[model samples]
Target: MPKIIRDLEKKIFNTSMELFLENGYEGVDMKMIAKKCSIAVGTLYNYYPNKKELYIAILNESWNDTFKRFDKLKTLQLTPREKVEKAILMLYEDIEKRRGLGKELLNKNIKDLIEDARVSEFKKALIKNMEMSISCLEKKEAYKDDNSINIRLAEILLVSIPILIESHRHEKEENIRFLNEMLDGFIL
Candidate 1:
């Protein structure tokens, strides 16, 4: 029989996230994580295999949490545009809460691993959610159905918001106002 460590994976994930957030990818290693978790290095490897894998796992979990929040918003009585606007704010809040981990994760050294990790699935999901919001608007009076336009809006928001966050962290209100204006042309 194999030895079991209760909540080992959760502990590992939490510890790894804390260390990575505090020290960055280069500053944290499997050994450090293992030591913090009071596990042998090999045991940690049994769970995560490598640092990149562990980092990707953390990225996936964080995005999943964000998506969960998105789902909760669906039950509200807000309009489609309101949903998208609120979701955009949630995305900004999520990135801001990460405390520079987003920038560190985008470092060139780890960009390849991010692709390999299928992190784009989160982007696709966000776009799909946005598309759903746009499609819902078509059912409302005076809104037209334009599949191509809806998709483009979704893709543009998916691509641009993070860039805005990274580039203009200090001017969030200005960025949101500009985005809302742009989105108004398409979404409203």
Candidate 2:
């Protein structure tokens, strides 16, 4: 009979997140995670076959929280420009709040470890949200012949906003203004 270890899974999940944030994907190993959790490496593996699986799980959980505020956006009555601005701000603040984990996940070596489907899903969601905000524009007839502009713009903002935030080279307001100014030509 196996002995029951209360909260072992929870402990492993939390400990793994903390360690990954501090050391990054390459810096962490199963043995290191087990050491932090006060468990054997095999025990950690029993829950997560490899670091990648654990990382995906963590990303899934964390990203849900990151996008949580988006739900309320639907209920707000705002102009298209305001909606876009708010959406960018929301994303910026959320990523900034989790900068440590965000930076770790964005590391080149660490990104390769994550599956494409997971990364695509995250981008798809962001793009979808941005598209929704853009779609609210009354000037839909202007680009009726070419509808993909929304998707392309969404992708651009989705990629650029995070990079700008992570760089710490500009203030949040500056990035927002820059993005809005750039968007004016296409959107406004």
Candidate 3:
């Protein structure tokens, strides 16, 4: 895509996410998105045929943005344990920053949008990034063994940390501390 087009798509996606978070999926419409984006409704449709498509584009952009940040972190010469800790912390912080829209974007029903080719490709990229991160942990002997169980467990922990943070967000500081300690025991 051209630079200008990509920029416009990103602006539209951000605006759509904010509107969706504020008004919910059913409450927001294409016109609202266009108005918020300061773009013509026709221009928005040129990029996304429908609201579901726009929403999936937003999800893909979010995931792509995350991997870009992680890519930069991957360049650091940190140990595997530090990598895992930092990755978890960074991901948690990002999710916390967009907690409301993140919750909506993660709804299981959104998987239906994966039927789109671009969305499916983005999902595959996410899985690949996750597996690479898991492999890094395995290299550090973080897992007890190379068995499928250990690998699966590592993947589970990688995905679960964010959920744990979300669930504990409203709890006391002590509870958050205890959860992190428990996670360190399992992850390290």
In order of appearance, the predictions have TM-scores of 0.70, 0.78, 0.66
Off by over 4 Å in 1: 1-11, 19-40, 100-118, 138-146
Tens digit of per-residue lDDT, candidate 3, span 1-188: 53255588778877898897788666789999998887789888998899987776666666667889789878889987566556656666665666554454345575545356776576456556555555565332554565554345445544565576667777534443553464455454
Local distance difference test values of all predictions, in order = 0.75, 0.75, 0.64
> Global lDDT for candidate 2?
0.75
- For residues 69-163, could you state the per-residue lDDT of candidate 2 as single tens digits? 67678678987778888887887777666555645434556556544677757657867888888777644456656778888777777678778
Q: Is candidate 1 or candidate 2 better by TM-score?
A: 2
**TM-score, cand. 2:** 0.78
User: Rank by TM-score, descending?
Assistant: 2, 1, 3
